[model samples]
Target: MTLLSYAKAMNRALADALEADPAVCVFGEDVGAGLAGLTLGLQQRFGAGRVVDVPLSEQAFTSAGIGAALNGMRPVIELQIPSLLFLVFEQLANQAHKFSLMTGGQARVPLTVVVPGSGSRSGWAGQHSDHPYGLFAHVGIKTLAPATPTDAYGLLSSAIRDDDPVVLFAPAGALGVREDVTAPLVPVPIGAARVHRAGSDVTVVAVGHLVHQALAVAEELAGEVSVEVLDPRTLYPLDRAALVESLGRTGRLVVVDDSNRFAGFAAEVLAVAAEECRLLAPPRRVTRPDGAVLPFALALDRALQPAAEQLRDAIRAVLK
Candidate 1:
């Protein structure tokens, strides 16, 4: 078995996609140099035309990607940092996302935006530490956050082939995750949630990299509480059926998300659980504070983000 790191998995997915499809191409600022590691060696193998490096302008390159998608080219845009997503919000949310709906399904923008390092990086401070996947999900754009190396490869492969616009966030924390690969990588469906560990006491729905934390917490509390760890790999188009099924067995819910508290991904999960499923007690969520800004200090950053301890407490509280 081979050990595959998350970033490498994404790199492999891109390589495979480029090799399989003549229309598949990539665009970014330093992609030609393979600066982000995900696009490493891609330009050399695919040539400069397919892996084109553009200006530093995020908006300009993003707009170009939309145009390419409209003209039958499947373009993948790599934004090195997550914060740059704010710069192209209008282009993604208003333009690329609306073309199919506004045109009555006539226009299809097969654009894939990948943020290799999303969420808080050490000392990156407030400006560069935003995890805004919820914002895109709110606007009806397909959003993905893969927790492991396998999902990273599978989801990205599927995203590149999707007809509509898709945004996939590879969390800064999960980038280092490595998996023991025993089989050939395959495309993961867009709206499936994987239950990493099954339990009967409570179901802990974790998003993105927090899936790891939830699994760790579940292991630690195994003797006392039976915690089921559920990873919502696809943020938007959430697999509500899986969620409802998990809740049916456990009758309790806790969501751990990296986004802010108000109208965040966790909030939406809680709403869905409360509305369609029966609960033994009020569901709880462990998430970053309302409108939280990560301080420059790493300690403060850790404190603001959701922790395993917070998850543990929520799990215990629901059992009371």
Candidate 2:
């Protein structure tokens, strides 16, 4: 078994994909030098043509990836910052994602947009700290946020192989998580949720880095209330069946997400549970304040983001 950090695992997965598939190519700014660590050694393994370093135009390169995907090539575009997604939303949501349906399945855009270090990173402030996966999910794009190294590797591979446009958000909070991987790395199918901890009292659905917080809170509440930690690895094509099953066992739900409160990912989960599931008490969502702009100051930024304490309180409230 080998222990690998989430960041290094991503790099390894990119290298593995490049080596295994001749159709896979990557394009982004600073990818040649591996400035984000996720592309380290990838340019060396694959030539400069495959690991391309494009100009600073996000929209151009993003559309170019769609063009490449249409031509039977799988293109993985790396966005250095998470908020850059806003700059290419038209390319991803309107163009690459809709090509299949718009053209009646005549074209397939196998483009994977990987945003490493998404969400807050200390003093990166508002511009660099925005977590906009909810926007993609709302737009019907395949969206995934991997919480562990193994999931990071597996999900990235799956995203690259899928015949649709996919957005992979690698949270900054989860970048440090290390996992002991024993078996050979394989692709984890999109739209499957994993139950990290089983409990009968309350089912806590956590997205992205909040999965770790959910598990920790579950452990802390073991003596008082049983808490189940549900990690919805793929946010867009959520495994609703698994979530319904969990809600059936617990009869209570709490969602912990990194996005803002109003119309965020947490809001969608709550809406779905309210419509389909039978809950003993009102479900609660622990998320950032509405329209939060992550301040440059440390304390202010931390306050704006969701915390484990808030999740624990939400769980307790839901169980009560």
- Candidate closest to the true structure, highest lDDT: 1
TM-score for each candidate, following the candidate numbering: 0.99, 0.99
Expressed as tens digits, the lDDT of each residue in 1-320 for candidate 2 is 89989999899888888888999999999999999988998888788999999999999999899999999999999999999999999989888989999999999999999999999997999899999999999999999999999999999999988999999999999999999988998888999999999999999999989899889888988999999999999998989999999999999999999999999999999888989999999999899999999999989999999898898788889866
Tens-digit lDDT track of model 1 for 212-309: 99999999999999999999899889999999999999999999999999999999999999899999999999999999999999999999999999
Error of 2 at 31 (Å): 0.6
Q: What TM-score does candidate 2 reach?
A: 0.99
TM-score of 1: 0.99
The CA lDDT of each predicted structure is: 0.96, 0.93
Residue 148 lDDT in candidate 1: 98
Question: Which residue ranges in model 1 land beyond 4 Å of their true spot?
Answer: none
